[model samples]
Target: MARPVWSGALTFGLVTLPVQMFTATESHTVHFHQLQRGTSDRVRNKRVNERTGDEVPLDEIVKGFDAGDEYVVVEPGELEDIAPGRSKALEITGFVDLEQVEPIFFDKTYYLGPKGKEYAKVYALMEKAMAHTGKAGIATFVMRNHQYLVAVKAEAGLLTLHTLHWADEIRDPRKEIGDLPAEAAVTDRELKMAEQLVETLSIDWKPEEFHDTFQEQVAKLIEAKRTGETVEKAEPPAASTNVVDLMEALRASVDRAKSPKDRRGQKAGGAAKTAARSTARSKRPSKASSFDSLTKAELYERATEAGIPGRSSMSREDLIEALRGARGRRRADAS
Candidate 1:
């Protein structure tokens, strides 16, 4: 059971729905300790006064904001009183179509669920309205000490609050992405080829298909070091750099993605070939497996029928081998 981090009522006209905020993400990074290079002595950070260059006691420490090199000491009680969310309420102004929102503005997400039994109907109504219309609520909310531009979105039958970035926070890529050479001209053939490549690579959203492979590999490498094992690291894939010939690169990528490994578990009889496909296990054996590929379930049944005790407890690999032997014996008896 998750405890609510915050409980608040959203105000849209006269409609008010009691909602609670819950953290959307959980960090799973293994905790590590800093230690001396030679000895295993743990190292610790010390609190020191930067202006005086002296170590300060825990009780003596105070926070101060530098105003033009002059320090303005901030009192804890005063800051808490001025904190935006002292009231702990979210006031929604109105909703807008999701298409109007920029992807760059999205920052952090929090799950919002009904606070009490009385709020359930209103919450559901709001969720359904947004989901049906493909719209998101533009809300103003404060959490901790910061006022946020928030978007209330319906996801998986519940309302989710995504804190958005202010316009000033986004850097204008146009600053670096300047004009190309005046003489640079794209032919109609080139444009057509580019469009075709884009169409081939276009995909539907499937969040589970994407992961932080670099992070996973780093974790594996750390585990290897911990277990006193050495493993060869795979070389990084080649990157495309010639923007002038981007269509050429995309053409190559599209061709490569059509290969056996890339086409696995995908239905190729439609448009949007790159759209993520769910790899559902087939009840019938795939052609790639032994004797027209037997499923683990079928193999286990075969093993049991052959008087292999505890076949149900056997692993998939064991079942496959056992079932193969059983089938071989049956074939031998027929001869």
Candidate 2:
């Protein structure tokens, strides 16, 4: 079981529900320690007194603010003592429609659960009420001596607390971005073509189907280096669309998006297989013909049927090669 990061009382109106907050997400990115070049020695950081040229113990450290001529030091305990509600209370000021909160303001998320089994009913009631009304409770609480503006939202039968950035923290993009296009005129034909392209490429949001390919490549690079093997370089980014041929590019994009292969890639379950099969049937010259004519989706279905290993991660060319190898081995066994 995961440990809760915080234990507090949630307050709204006359009700008080004891809850525990657990971190909702964690990073899986590969991390590396700093090392000196041409040596295996790890480069570590240490806190040292500048004037004395000696290491300083953590206990001796204090938060300091420079006030032009001098430094104002503050103790850790002093901040905790001054924290709102002594950092134990999460009080909801009001509830608002979830859509009213801009996505830009949201930050980290924490799963909020009933602290004790006895408080389950109260927790469920609050979650269900908020979920039914599509509302989020706007709250303020102090945690780890820092006050946070948060939204308590109901998600999948549980409450989730999202920390938010204060209004002053958000930068004005209009002031920051100098090259933003100012009301550029878009031709009606180009707009229609672009809309058509979007419609053809639109897909239902299935987060599971997407992944961090760059991270995967990074892992592959590490493994390849360890094993003295070569890793394939990733494809270069696409060239910027030519302004002179905007309509032509849009039309071509729409055509490509409408292709059965691209359409099948977006679909899932039986629909994907059906589309792949249909494409194969329409494109395949003969049963004995080469797999070059088949799309990656069709090759993947064939690979799945054959139980070829690593088919999920393989490219279209890789799939075709694997399928051919599988067929050759099957023929050899039969003979």
Candidate 3:
């Protein structure tokens, strides 16, 4: 079990329950340590005195706030003495409909669990009540020397505390983005086609379906370097079409959505010729493996089934090579 980062009392009205806070989410990004470019020596950062150009010890360090011509130095104990004592309790000020809380205000989330068996009953009662009403409790509590605006909501019989940004923190996009586009006209036919394309590609929301592709590529690059393998750079994507080709681009996009990798020969009079070529290729049957004819999407599916690592970010050619290696290994295992 994961350790709780905080312990406190959850208070509202006459109810008080001992609760512990555990982080609800964690990042999976690969991190690297700083090292010298040509050597194995580790690179480190140090605190130094700017005036004397000397390294400073941790005990000698003091935080200061810039005040015009000079800085006001403050001691750690002085700050702690003034820190709010409300950190020991999460006190709910009021309840509001969950829909009122926009996603932009939400920051870090933590799961609030009952601290002891005796508090479990009250904890569950509050959780079920909030879930049933579809409401969240608005609260303010200090944690780690900072007071946070939070929304306490119930998720699967557990209370979740989401830190929220202050109202002033959310900037007005209209002012920052400047020059909003004038309302443009869209044709009925184009609208229908766009909606149809969206419907064709829509699927049930599954968080697991998405992943960090760039991070996976970075990991693959590091592993390749460690194993002395040659890493091929991917070709850059083509620039987007100009405004004149909007209709044609939309049509092509719809076709690509309808058939993920089969939009190459989709012109008005090309179907017959495409069919003839396919028929001839089917009859000729080259000595090479059928995998060569598969599209990148198809190759990725096969690589996934074969349990090839780093398949998520592999190019079409790299996927083909990995699949070929997997086939060889399977044959050796069978032999």
Off by over 4 Å in 1: 51-61, 176-184, 237-251, 259-335
Candidate 3 has which clashing residue pairs, if any? none
Per-residue lDDT tens digits of candidate 2, residues 25-128?
Answer: 99889898899999999999999999998999999999998999999999999999999999999999999998999999999999999999999999999999
Candidate with maximal TM-score: 2
Candidate 1 least-lDDT 10 residues: 273-282
Off by over 4 Å in 3: 178-180, 259-335
lDDT per residue (tens digit) for residues 34-88 in model 1 = 9999999999998878898899998776678989879999775666687665647
Q: Which is better, 2 or 3, measured by TM-score?
A: 2
Q: Tell me the tens digit of each residue's lDDT in model 3 across 1-335.
A: 89999888888899998899999999998988899999989999999888998999999998899999999999867766775654687889899999899999999999999998988899999999999999999988777767789999998778999999999999988788778766778889778877876885565665665567667778889999999997657556667887687666666555544442344555644776557546644654343557778767657656654656666566767788888888889889999
Whole-model lDDT, model 2: 0.84
**TM-score, cand. 3 vs. native:** 0.78
Kindly report which residue stretches of model 2 are placed more than 4 angstroms away from their true locations once superposed.
Answer: 260-335
Clashing residue pairs for model 1: none
After superposition on all C-alphas, the RMSD of every candidate to the true structure, in Å, is 11.0, 7.4, 5.6
